[model samples]
Target chain A: MKIDKESIKKIAHLARLEFDENSAEKMSKDMSKILDWVEQLNEVDTSNVEPLTTMSSEVNDMREDKVGTHMSHDEALKNAPKRDSDYFRVPKVLE
Target chain B: MEKFSSFDEIKKSLEKKETDCRAIVEYYLKNIQTKAHLNAFVDVYEQSALEKADQLDEKIAKGKAGKLAGMVVGIKDVLNYQGQEANASSKILKGYISQFTTTAVQRLIDEDAIIIGRLNCDEFGMGSSNENSAHGKVLNALDESRVPGGSSGGSAVAVQANLCTVSLGTDTGGSVRQPAAFTGIIGMKPTYSRVSRWGLIAYASSFDTIGIFSKTVKDNALVMEIMAGHDEMDSTSSRKPVHPYSELLHFDKKVKIAYIQETIDSSALQPEIKENTLSVLEKLKAEGHEVEEVHFPLLKYALPTYYILTTAEASSNLSRFDGVKYGYRTPNAHNLESMYKLTRSEGFSEEVKRRIMLGTFVLSASYYDAYFTKAQKVRRLIKDFSENLLADFDYIIMPTTPTTAFKFGEHSGDPVAMYLEDLFTVQASVSGVPAISLPNGKDKSGMPIGLQILANSFKEAELYAFSNYITQITS
Candidate 1:
C-alpha cells in the first residue's frame, strides 16, 4: 500500500494533473498517510454487504426523448479558451 | 422601524405594510457593503436585486405576494443561477457561466425570493475550512482570526452577519453543518436526493446535497418545503411528495432520543463542547423526552468511508474539465495530453490536486477492490447501522463538531486533521437521512456549539417539528 514517487506520477498522469519533483514527493507522503488511515475499512467484515450506488431506491424517471433548444451553438462555445468558427480548437491529433 | 431579525420577521413587516421589498433589499445591501471584511460574498447583484425587489413590491401592492416575499437569499458558488458565474470557488472554472438555473434556486425565485449574491466556498466544496477557496478564506464574523468552518463558511457567515436574510449551501460531508456550527447558525442537510443536484457543480455526485443555512430552524423548514421535490433534470432527485414542513412544526408527543456514548466521551472532543452537549441532553431529558446512551462502534469508520467515496467520485466528476469546451486552459502546451495536464495542474489548487491524485490512486486498476470497493461496502454498513438505530430511537443527538471553530493555521498543516472535522456529520449523509445542526449551546470562549439531530430518510417534517420543539423549550 506504500505509494512511491513513481506511483504518484502515474496517478497524476491518470488524473491529467502535473507536479514538480518536490510536490510529487510531498504528494507521495500525503497519499501514503491518507491510504494508511483509510485502510481501517479492511477491519470491517463486509463479505455479504452490497456496494451502494444510490441512496434512494427510486427508479430513474422515464420521459420521451425530445429535442429542443437548450443552448445555441454560440452559447455552448462561449466559454471555450480556443475556438475556430463554430468548433472548439485543440492541437492537431493526426499527422 | 424595528430591524428585522429573521426572514419570518421581515415577512410579517411586509404583510403589515411597514416595510416594502425595496427597503429590505437596500438594508441588506448596505449591511453587505459594511461587512466586506468577512469575505462572505463573492458576487453581489445590487442593481438586479433592487430591480427584483421593486418588482416584488409591485406584486405586494397588488396583493399577489408569494411565500418568500422580500427575503434576500444568498447562494453558494456551486449552485447554477443561469448566466451567473458558478466557479465553484475554483480558478479552473473562472470564466464559466451556468447555462441553466438549478431547480432549487428556481424554486426560491418562484416563491418571490430575491437573490442578493453568490457566497464563497471551498473550491469545488472540498475543504473543511474555507481556506481552500481560490477566491480567499472567509473569516468568521464573530472572531476574525478564526476560520469559518467550510466549504459553506460564507453561506453561514452571511446569515450570521445578517448580510442576507437566508442562504443556500451544499453539504457533501458536513460542509453546511460544520460551518453553521462554527458561525452559531442553523444548517440542515435534508435526506439525500431531497433537493435536486442537476445544477450544482459536482463535488461528489452521490453524496453532494443542497442544504440551507439560516438563523432559525423554522427558516430552514420553510426553504426546504419550497425546494424539495423531484426534478426531471436530476435523475437522483427523490420522487417523494413534498410536504408543508413549516406547518408541521408542532411536536405534541414526547420523542425518544439516543446520544452516542462514544462521540461525547471521545478524547478528540473539546472539554467545553462535550460538557455543553451533555448539558443539552440532560435538559432534553428533563423536558420529558426519553433520552439514553447508545453505542455505535462503527462511528470511527464514517470519516474514512466518506472521504474515500467522495474523493473517488470527485475525481471522476472533475475529469470533464479538460481544456476542451470551458474552464481555464493553460497557455503553454504542445499536444492535447499536455494541454489537459498543464491546464489542470495550473487551474486546481493544492488541496484539489492532492484529492484528485488520491482519488485516482484509489480507483486505479491495482487497488480498486482494496480502496474504492471496500469503501463502498463500508458505506453500506454505516447506512444500515444508522437506519437500524433510527428505527428504534426517534432521533439521534450528537455534537455537530468535536470542537468549535478552529483558529487559522491550527489544522491546516494536516489534511487528516481537517478530515476529522467531518466525523460527526457524515453518517447522516452516508445514510441518506435528514439531519439538522441547531445552535443549542455555546462554549466557554463564547463561540457556538451545535447540537446535531438526525431523523430517518424523507422524514424532514418530523425533523423540523422536533427541532422547533427543542428550540421552543430550550431557547
Candidate 2:
C-alpha cells in the first residue's frame, strides 16, 4: 500500500496534473495512508458478488438515436479559451 | 414582514393579499444582504429575481400562477444556470458560463420558483468541508467559528438562515445531509435517477444526486415533487411516476425501523448524538412502531467502498477540464502536455489533486483489479446488504454525522479524517436509497444533532411522510 514518489509522478502524469517534489512527496504519503486505510475493504468476502456499477435497477441502456437539445455553432464556441471564429484553438501538439 | 417556513404559509399570505411575490423575494434579498458575512451565495441575481417576482405577482393576481410561484430558491454552484457562472467553486471554471440551464433548474423555474442566486460549495463537490471552495468557505450561521458541513454547506446555510425558502444541493455521499445536520434543517437525497442529472456538473456521477434543503418537510416534498420527474436529457433518469410527495404527508401506519447497533455504539459518536438518536428510537417504540437494533458488519467497509468508487469516477469525470474548451488556461504553457498539466495544477485545490491521483493509481493497469475491481464488488455487497435489510425493515435510523459542526480546520489536516465525517450518511448514498436528515434537538453546546432515516429506493412519498411525522413527534 506504500505509494512511492515515482508512482506519484506516474499517476499525476496520467491524471494530467503536476506537483512539485515536496507536494508530490506529501501526496505520496497521503495516498499511502488513504490506500492503507482502504485496504480494509479486502476483508469483505465479495468473491460471489457482481460489481454494481450502475445505481438504478431500471435504467434505459440506450438513448434514442434522435437528436436532443444541443447548442448552436456560435453557442458551442462561446466558452472556448483560445478560440478562433469557429474552432477552439489549443497549443500545438505536433512538431 | 414575518418569516415564512413553508410554501403553504407563503401561499396563504398571497391569497390574503397580505404579501405579494415581490415582497417575499425582497424579504429574502434583505436577509441575504444582512447576513452577507456567512458567504452563502456565490452570486445573487437581484435584478433577475425582482423582475421574475413582479411578473409572478401579476400572474398570481390573475389567478394563473405556477405551482412554486411564491417560492424562492438558491442553487448550489454546480448546477448550470444558462448564462450565469457555474464554477462548482473551482478556479478552473471561474469565468465559464453555462450554455443551457440544467434540467432540474429549468423545472424549478418552469414552476415559477424565483432563483435568488448560486450558492458556494466545495470545489467540484469533492471536499466534505466548504473550506476547499475557491470562492472561500461558508460560515455556519448558528456558530460562525465552526465549519458548516459541506460540499453543499452554502445551500444548507441559506435555508438555515432563512435566506431562501428552499435551496438545491447535490449529495454524492453526504454533502447535503451532513451540512443540513450541521445547520439544523431538513435535507433530502432522493433515490438515484429520481431527479434528472442532465446539466449538473459532474463529480462522482454514480453517487451524485441533486438534493434539497428546507426548514419544513412539506416544503422539501413540494420542491422534490417538481424536481423528481424523468427527463429526455438524462437517459439514466427513472421513468417511474413521481408521486405528489407534498400531498401525501400523512402517515397513519405503523412501520418497522432498524438502527445499526455498530453505529450507535461506536466510540466516535458524540454522546449527545447517541442519546438523541436513542431517545428518538424510544419515541418510535412508544408510538407502537417496531424498532430493532441490527448488526451491519459491513458498515465499516462503506467508507472505503465509497472513496474508491467516487475517486475513480471523479478522475475520469474531471478529465474534460483541460484548458482547451473553457475556463482557466495557464499563460506559461508552451505546448499541449504542459497546458493540461500546468492549468490543472494551478486550477485545482490540494484535495482535488489528491483524489485525482488516488483515482489514477487505483485504475492503473497494474493495480486495477486489486483496488478498482475489488472496491466495486464491495460496493455491491454494501448496496445489497442495505437493500435486503430495507426489505424487512421499513427504515434505518441514525445520526447524520458522528459529531455536530466542528470548528474550522478541525479535520482538514488529514484527508482520511475529513472523509470520516460522512461515515453515517454514506450508507444511504451507497444504497442509492432515499434518506433524510431531520433536525434532532441541539447538543449541550446548542449545535444541532440530525436524525437520519433511510428507506427503500423510489419510496420518496413514504420517506417524506415518515420524515414529516418524525419531525413533528420529535420536535
Candidate 3:
C-alpha cells in the first residue's frame, strides 16, 4: 500500500503518460489509498476459489475465418490527428 | 397527449401522421437545447437527424416503414456512427470522426430509428459519475446538483428528460444501470455476445456490453431485439437466433426470484435504498410468484476483481490510442516516446490517467501474478458463485446501487468512494450475466432508487420476462 513517488513515475511511463511533479505527488497519495482499500481482499480466504478469466463456462464461440474488406487506408487514417498520405505521422521513433 | 408515453404510442402517432418525424425530431431537439445546461449531449446532429426523418417519412409513404419508423434514439459517444464525431468524451479523441457505423446503431437505422445525437460519458467509460467526461459532467434530470450516474450518464439523462425515446449506453461495471437508477429509467446490460460490439470504442473488451436505457421495459426489449444478434465483424457476437422479446411476457409460467440477503443487509447500503428495494421484493411476493433469499459470498470481492480485470484489459485496448493514430497528437514532442507521453497526458483526463497508471501497475511484468492473476482468480470465484446460485434461482435480485444518487461533488474528491458506488453491480459484469436496473421507488429526498435483476448468461428473455412481471405488479 506504500506507493513511492518513483513508482508513480515508473507507472506513468509504463502507461505511456506524463505526470508533472505536483500531479505525481497527488497520484502517489491517491494510488496508496486505492491500493490500501484493495488490500482488504487479501484478508478473504480464496484458497479454494479458482481465478476467473472468461465469464461464460461455455467456450469456443469463434466465428468462421473469412476475409472481408475493413476500412480503407484513407478511411482509417481520416481520424488521425497527425497523419501523412500513407501513414499516421508521429514524432520519429528512432533518433 | 401524454407526449408519447411509450414506443407503441409513438408508432401509432407516426402511422396516423399526428406528428411527423420532422416535428418529433424538432421537439426533441428543442428539449435537448433547453437542457444544454446539463451537458447531456456532446453533439446534436440536427441536419442529419432532419434528413433521416425525411427519408423515414418517404419510407412511410411507400408503406415500408418499420416499428420504430419515427422514433429518435440518443447514442453514447463511444459508439461509431458514420461521419459523426465519436469523441468518447475524451480530449484524446477530440475531432475524430467514425468511418463506419456500429452494428447496433446501424441496425437501429435499418429499422427506421433516427439518430438524434451523441450523449456524453466519462472519458473511455472510466468513472462511476459523469464528472470525468472532457465534455463536462451531465446533471441528473431530477436534480441538477446530483450526478446522473455514469459513464452512461448522458444517455440515461436524455431518456429521463424525454430528449429521445430511448438511448444506447455501454455498461462496463454499472455504466448503464447505475445511471438509469439515478435518473428513474430502465437500463439493461444484455448477456455478453448477445449484442454485437463492432464499432464500439473498446474500454474493457471483455466486460464492455452495449446496453439500452428506456422509459419502459417494453421499449428496452423492442430496441434490444433490433440491435441483438451476430455480426461477422465482431468476434464475440452470438450466433444464436434473435427472438421477439415482447412475446415472452405473455407466458404465464411462474418464475423463481432470488434476492441477495447479504447484500441487502450490508451496512454500507443507505437505509432508503434498502427500504425501497425490500418494498419491491414485497411487491413481487404479493404476486403469485416465488421469492427467496440466496447467498453469494464471493460477491464481496467483485469490485476489486472487476477493477483488476477491466483495468488490465483497458491498458492493452487503449494502447492503440497512442496519439500517432486516429486521435489527438502533440506537436511539441521531439521524440516518439515524448509524443506518446505528451499527447496522452494532454488528451486524457486525470481519472483516465489514474486508471491507466493503475492498469500499468497491475499488468506490469513483476506485479501481474500478485495483482492481475489474483484478481482473475477472485473473478472466477465470483462467476462460480453466480453459476451455482443460478442452478436454484431463476433470477438474482439486489439494489442496483448501495445508495440513491449522490450530489455531483459528494464523492468527486474521493476516487475510492466513487469506485465503491459500483459494488452492488460489478458482479454481473464479472459473470457476464444479463442484468437490468428498474426504477423501484423514491428515497427520502424523493430521488429514484432501482432494483437490479440478474439472470444466467444468455438468458435475457427470462430476465426481461421477470422484469416485465415485476414492473406490472409494482405498478
Candidate 4:
C-alpha cells in the first residue's frame, strides 16, 4: 500500500515505463494517494462474493468454422512503426 | 437555410425539398469553422462529408434513403473510422490511421449518417476534463474558461455548438453523460454489450460503451437505435433485439423513482446542483409519479472499484502499443527492453504512465488478491446493490456530476480531485446498466446541471421514453 521510489521503480519496470527520480517521486506520491483512496473497499465484506469480470449476461459467441476474409499480411503490416518487408523490425532481441 | 434543432425537422425539410443535404452540410460546416477556437474536432472530413451530402441528396430524391439520411455526426477520437486517424488524443498513436471502421460508426454510416469528423478526447479516454488531450483542451462553448467535462469534451461541445446534429462518444466512466451535463445537451450510455465495441480504442474493455450526445432526446435515441445490437466482431455485444427507441418516446403512465438520499444531501454537491435536482424531483412528484428517497451506501466504493478495474484493463490493453506494431517509437533505444521502456515513457503522458504503473502495481504478484480480485468482488457487490434498487424502483435518479462546469486548472494539479469528478456518474458504468444525463437546468453561473437517471440492464427503451417525457415536461 505504501508506494515509494523503490516501488515506483519496480512498477515502472513491470509496466515497461521509465521515469527519472523526480517524476518517480511525484508518481509515487500520486500512486500512494490513489491506492490509499481505493483502500476504502476493505470495509466491505467480500468473502462470499464472486469476482465479476464482465457484466454481459451472455457467454461465448460460438460460430461455425469457415474461411473468412481477414486482414492481409500487407494490410496488417501497414501500420508497423519499424517494418522490414512484411516483418515488424525491433531492437535485436536475442543479442 | 434555417437552423434545425432535431433530425425530425431536418427530415421534414429534406422531404419537402426546402433544405437539401448539401445545404445542411454547409450549415454545419459553417458552424464548425466558426467554432474552430473550441478545438472540438481533431480532423474534419470536409471533402468526404460534402461528397456524402451530395450522394444523400440523390438518395433523398429517389426516396431510397436510410433512417439517418442527411444526419451529420461527429465521432469521438477514440472510435476508429477507416482511413481516418483515431489517435485518442494521445501522441503515442499520433498519426495512426484506422484500417477498419468501428462497428458503431459503421452502423451510422450504413444508415446514411455523414461522419463529419473525429472529435478530440482525453488521451485514451482517461481524464475527467478534456485537459489531458494532446490535441489541446476543448473549450466549453458557453464559457471558454470552463471545461466541457470530458473525456468526451469535444463530443459534447460539438453537439452543444451545433457543429453536428449529434456526436458519438465512448463512456468508460461518465465520459459521455458528464460532458453532456456540462454542456447542457442530452447524453445517454446504453447498457453494457448493447453496442458493439469492435473498433473502439480500448481503455477498459468491460467498462467502455459507445454513447450518444445530442441536443434532443429523439436524436440520441435514433442514433442509439442505429448503433445498438450484436456484432460478430465484438463477442461481448448483446444478442438482445435492438429497439426503435425514437418511436417509443410516448410515456403515459407514471413510474416509480428513487433519488439517492445520501447523494442529494452530500456536502460535495454544489448548492445550485442540489436545488435543480430537487426541483426536478418535485416536478415529477407533482406530475403524480411515486418518488422516494433511497440509500445507496455502496456509492462511495463505486469510484475506487471502477478506477482499480479499469486501470488494470487499460494496462493490459495498452500493452499492445509496444512501438513495433503501430504508433510512436522511440529513436533512442538500442536494446529491446529499453525500446519498450523509452518508447512507452516518451510516448505516453504522465497520467497514462501513472495509471499503467498503478495497474501493474495492483496486479503484481504480491498484491493481486488485495487490490485487483478484491475490487472485482466489491464490484459485484456494487452491481448487485444497484440492480436490487432498480428491481423495486422503476428508475434511480441522481445528479450527473457533483458540480457544474468547473474552471480549467481547477483540478488539473490533483489527480484524485479530477478522479472525483466521476463521483456521481460511475455507478451506471460499474453496474453495466443504461443511464442518461438530461439537462436539469442551469446554475447561478449559467453552467448546466444534469439529472442522471439509471434503469435496469437492457432497458434502454424505457430509459429513452422516460427521458423524453422529462424533457417534454421540463423544457
What are the chain B TM-scores of all models?
Answer: 0.99, 0.99, 0.98, 0.99
The segments of candidate 2 whose C-alpha lies over 4 angstroms from its true place after superposition are A61-64
Candidate 1, after superposition: displacement of residue B359 in Å?
1.1
TM-scores for all predictions? 0.98, 0.99, 0.97, 0.99
Candidate 3 wrongly placed segments (more than 4 Å): A48-50, A56-67
Error of 1 at B24 (Å): 0.3
The 10-residue segment with the lowest total lDDT in model 2 chain A: A55-64
Cα lDDT tens digits, model 1, B1-475, are 4666688899888878889999999999889999998999999999999999999999989989889988899999999998888899998999898888989999999999999999999999998889999889999998999998998999999999999989999999999999999999999999998888988999998888999998887888999999999988888788889999998988789889999988988889999888878888888888888999999898999999998888899899999899889989998988888899999999999999988888887888988888899999999989998999999999999999999998998998899999999989999988888899998677777889888999988899999999988788778
TM-score: model 1 vs. ground truth: 0.98
lDDT tens digits, residue span B204-283, model 2 = 98899999999999999999999998787887889899999999999999999999999999888999999999999999
Number of backbone collisions per candidate, in order?
Answer: 0, 0, 3, 0
Task: Tell me how much of the true interface, by contacts, candidate 2 captures.
Answer: 0.85
**Predictions' DockQ, in order:** 0.77, 0.80, 0.68, 0.83
- Tens-place lDDT per residue, model 3, B49-123, is 999989888888999887788789999999999988888999898888889999999999888899999999999
Q: Output the better candidate (1/4) by DockQ.
A: 4
Clashing pairs for model 3 are: A51-B377, A52-B376, A52-B380
Worst 10 residues of 2 chain B by lDDT: B229-238
The pairs that clash in candidate 2 are none
TM-score of candidate 3 against the unseen true structure: 0.97
- Rank list by DockQ: 4, 2, 1, 3
The TM-scores of chain A alone, one per candidate, are 0.91, 0.88, 0.89, 0.91
Q: How far in Å is the alpha carbon of B468 misplaced in model 4?
A: 0.6
The runs of at least 3 residues in candidate 4 whose Cα sits more than 4 Å from the true structure, single-residue gaps closed, are none
